[model samples]
Target: MREEYRGEKGTTTTGFDLGRVMWVRKEPSHDGLIVPKAEYEQEREEYKGWIAKEIELRGVPGQLHFKFVRDTMRMNTDGVLMVVDSSDYAMIGDASAILAETIASFGNIPMEVIANKQDRNDAASPQEVASWLGVESATGTCAKDHESAKNALIRLLKKLE
Candidate 1:
């Protein structure tokens, strides 16, 4: 899902599906109701109110210039999965800054922080990273390891539910 890698230190291999872990399709608005565009448009008079059936987690690209896309996503985002490179000590500052900004922008939303590259010898512990970022906890993950990545996303999805 990610367009580019952050080139974190101690990274062994970046999985092709690193950030594409979850994607729930939008509600079938065409199932005799209205249309999928309803989410971005005014409700039909026939339906008194909007009932959001589910949240679709789209991967917002990490590029700096894609701010506009992320802004658009803020309107519909129900939860966030922020993956950080645990071994990248140099980039931790940037990560924490972005994390704080993201939390503010999506106030009160469920956010899961993944301390990735946990397989790296120099990687910081997930608990340490979480504490540094001021989050209660973080999931340790080696994205290249399928099970680790799957488990992290599964736990976050559960919290979102």
Candidate 2:
């Protein structure tokens, strides 16, 4: 995926806003399967899980927009994984405020913060990011390190569970 940023001209590098909203259909996958209602519901749940996994596997690139983030949270979200750039101290305050507002508006949902870009020389520490975000825990991650990224994701998922 291509990296997109919000430009000063109220435009984004990507044609559309990088934010994404995923919705899971509750309806059965097959119309003529003739399965029991309970069975169909179970299958639908499994399908939703599969879809979520697929999305995670095929990651998208884009900055999160407040509107889009709100819309996505309105869906059947089990948890939220917030990724922050540890090197961008200037944006941290604004981002933290928005995150706090979103959390308050949406109710207390499971959330985990990932302090990314640890490879940068000027990147803030995980503890510093956590403090700035008002989160008790934040996973440290270097995007270039596949193992570190994967481990951080796993830790967040574990917390969600």
Candidate 3:
């Protein structure tokens, strides 16, 4: 079980009781095992148990469950609490406005947006989208461009770090 990496990435409103998500960076110690602090350990264990139960409920294969957990853990540690959606996306009529409200509710952290296929007669801009969302407009990026996405993510992470 020790070798089994169980964790997840990204934010979710699902009833995944992680107790509390924490940011932990390994200290520059010469020790072999980088054991997490006692408090973080407890939270991690709780998160693991919750994830396992959810997987069981969904009747997913062990391998897939393992992947989900790993992704979640990664997100919990390294992912920023940001939502990505498009203005045209139906879930939120105006994705930017909805995102802004969500960010406000969650408390401010470095947020970024990748406006996919934004409508513009040369008037649509990243600033316009960011302004609508009430976030400091990040450089708008194209989802099809991998480098652009990476840059956007890096930009946000650096701010958080």
State how far residue 60 of model 2 sits from its true place (Å).
8.5
What is the per-residue lDDT of model 1 for residues 1-161, given as tens digits with 9 covering 90 to 100? 76776675563444443333222223433222223343334544534444433334466765556668878878866678888889988877878777877877888888889999999999999999998899999999996797776667656656766
Using lDDT as the measure, what is the rank order of every candidate, best first?
A: 1, 2, 3
RMSD of each: 10.8, 10.8, 14.8
lDDT tens per residue, model 2, 53-77 = 2122212232445456566545666
Error of 1 at 68 (Å): 3.0
In candidate 1, stretches whose alpha carbon ends up further than 4 angstroms from where it belongs are 1-55, 63-65
Q: Spell out the clash pairs found in candidate 3.
A: 7-69, 7-73, 8-71, 8-72, 8-73, 9-71, 9-72, 9-75
lDDT score, residue 132, model 2? 84
Clashing pairs in 2: none
The window of 10 residues in a row where model 2 has the poorest summed lDDT is 51-60
Model 3 misplaced regions, further than 4 Å: 1-97, 118-123
The TM-score values for the models, in the order shown, are 0.63, 0.58, 0.40
What C-alpha lDDT does candidate 2 achieve relative to the native structure? Answer: 0.61
TM-score, model 2 to reference: 0.58
Query: Candidate 1 — worst ten consecutive residues by lDDT sum?
Result: 25-34
Quantify all predictions' global Cα lDDT against the true fold.
Answer: 0.69, 0.61, 0.43
Q: What does the lDDT read for residue 17 in candidate 3?
A: 35
